[model samples]
Target: MANENGEGEDIPVAANVLGTIGTILWCIQLVPQIWYNWRRKKTEGLPASMMLLWATCAVPLGIYLVLQNVNIPLQIQPQIFGALSYVTWGQILYYDHGYSRLKAIVVVLAASAISGGLEALFILTLRIPYRKGTTWPALFFGIIAAIMLTLGLIPPYFEIRKRHGRVIGINWFFLAIDTFGALFSLFSLAAQKSFDILGGVNYILVALLEFGIYGCHTVWRIRNRKLLREAKKSGRSVDELLEERELERQRQRELESSNGERFTGIDYDEEKSRPSTEAHSVDGGFVQEPAGWHRT
Candidate 1:
């Protein structure tokens, strides 16, 4: 193959093959998270900052990959990643933070526009005479993206710690898939005629972070299953145990409200004072009272 400077270079076929696999993996990496959020109808423990930073990082990454004349699949990979990340971020805002649908949509659009515009500006600026034939600009942006990716995992790590080692609201399968994708991307980078040092480091860090998350998730699941078994032994269903937990959480919120915590729009006192009503099991594994009725 011929380099951009018209010099002869041996491009490995394996590099392109691995890059294609990495591209495919990256494209679908977010699907599990998206599906998990949709099915759960919540994003409680997911970090919006992580998604936002990663999405922003992708703008520079895409520009760098394209400017370096990487394979077409690699060039397109970051765009897909950014778009999906924005969607995940929007889900967090809408479901976890209770943003209105219109507000979430506006925010996602604004972010996408800003990132895309910045990437375009960089692409144009890097095409100037002095920067045109050099790899410095691409390398600089790639390093920046790598740093952003490494830092993005910090919030999620803290979130897990704050939850007492419980991996709530995170989909382990998603993390596993993402880690594998990062591993494949590292292999792809290694097979290149000139390996991307920054990219390889970024993928390695991402894979390690994701694997750590998976480990935490496994431990959390084991703990939860043990608790569920204990509940069963006590003649209680898991749903009942979960409902108790929810009630406890609600009571804690009420206590906070009484102690001058911010208003949450719910009249906790009124709910508490309502007349007793029979609880009925619902298909979703929760207990509910009849409409116009309340539990004492």
Candidate 2:
């Protein structure tokens, strides 16, 4: 769909280099997250929906790349990227959602197959129109891909909101990789001979949202550091401090409830029992776990 006579545009060298880096980053971005989930035996604050949405995104994106006949790495990226997303999503199911190992494998494999088939079908459907000098059809797929991609990043923000402005329960390394991938891909778009509005918008949305997450992380970390110092100064463990904070938050929640009712039920403040209910549980919980200073 490059010209009315049917030709492919030349991919500029800068674009090629940048696109390759972005492709590589995205292709393997989820590995760290998957490994983190496996090592922790929990998904924690990572949202399963984000992974699935990304996996779904690969379908339309694969079709767009196929029809556009882009660079080799770019052409292959959506496929591998989506497959890895599926595997990562499966990990969430197994570790976070309590799916059996066998079930997770089965689900991931099945979803991958269905997604691959759907992508192929769309490519076949659009290939003729694209060759006949129609660009909008292929462009439509790109737009859909972009929308799906942006949607995938939104779930984490909700998790952050639920945790009261904290971006918690995700691997910092994983988030860094994803944000860089989007940023590099954006630069790659700028390097192109002609900017793809759809693609540019996608990367922009991703970068902006991820940067916001980083901002939230920064603010949360700064405040958390102060709390850590106070905890240490008072000869109270971080867990105990967290317990008190959680109890206070619970009281706030009860106060904010629409029922206009509040109840006090804290058994700590001056002192608390080991493995207290208010203590952020390493053994009993990791969801939205506070990033307190490491004791060891």
Candidate 3:
């Protein structure tokens, strides 16, 4: 049966089913990351570049899907994906990079507008009949989009590697959904007898990278748990360990805050001449005498 667009290809029912599933997955894929960022009020290890590139690639990918006259579910997948990606990117800019709200909004909107304009131009140019029953221009854009999608994963891959595979600020649930969505999209393409080599490779790479990160997170968690157990055996409360970690982080933040200042105008010599406080060692290794108390 011909599609509404009069494209001669007969899309399979199974393809529509798989495509719908993939579309749903992709639609909600970034929600976890967005929610995580909101709850934590931080985007520490999330790669803004990854989100930006993926959002940009979606414009061409959406155009290609429309040109190919794929099912409506597949056609709209890239748009939703792109919208969520832009949101995620904005979060990174705002939280991690300290971008002002107005600045982040302007940047995201500008990028989105540029992408939409380019896609429109490409679609119009590609629809021109260059040969008998073949739209080489659409195919060209599709290939480029696929390559861009694959390349977008590079930033996150290095981020994970830099953390020695620890998940860090990444939302693992987002990765799982994204990987599954890519796999289902591949199946959809295969069902339609339109399996693209680049598309397949892109999905494979996404799944592999996500799984690698998952494995690394699992290992790190296991190791941390073992150390915690050891600490517990040494009569240390887990609460104490957590408190110590928090204190260390506080110290780091304080050090960063005090990096460029000299202690002002305090005359230590005159203060010492007036009175001296006795110092003593205590359980936590510090003690100080009360003000105006002299050692006798």
Better of 1 and 2 by TM-score: 2
Q: Give the alpha carbon lDDT tens digit for every residue of 1-296 in model 1.
A: 00111124565777656656666877778889999999988998889998998889898787777777655666777898899999999999999898998999999999999999999888887866324467777778878878887888878888988765667777877776677777777887777778766667778888788778778767876878877787879999665887788899999998987766434434666666775566676676767564667556
Counting clashing residue pairs in each candidate, in order, gives 0, 0, 0
Error of 1 at 184 (Å): 1.0
Better of 2 and 3 by TM-score: 2
C-alpha lDDT of all candidate models, in order: 0.77, 0.78, 0.75
**In model 3, where is the ten-residue run with the lowest total lDDT?**
1-10
TM-score of 3: 0.71
lDDT of 1 at 68: 71
Q: State the number of backbone clashes in model 1.
A: 0
Task: Write one digit per residue (lDDT tens) for candidate 2, span 68-171.
Answer: 88666677888888988998899889887989999999999999999999999888888998889887987787888889889988999899887656765588
Cα RMSD of all models vs. native, in order, equals 16.9, 17.8, 12.2
lDDT of 1 at 102: 99
Best by lDDT: 2
- Flag regions of model 2 displaced more than 4 Å: 1-8, 230-240, 248-296
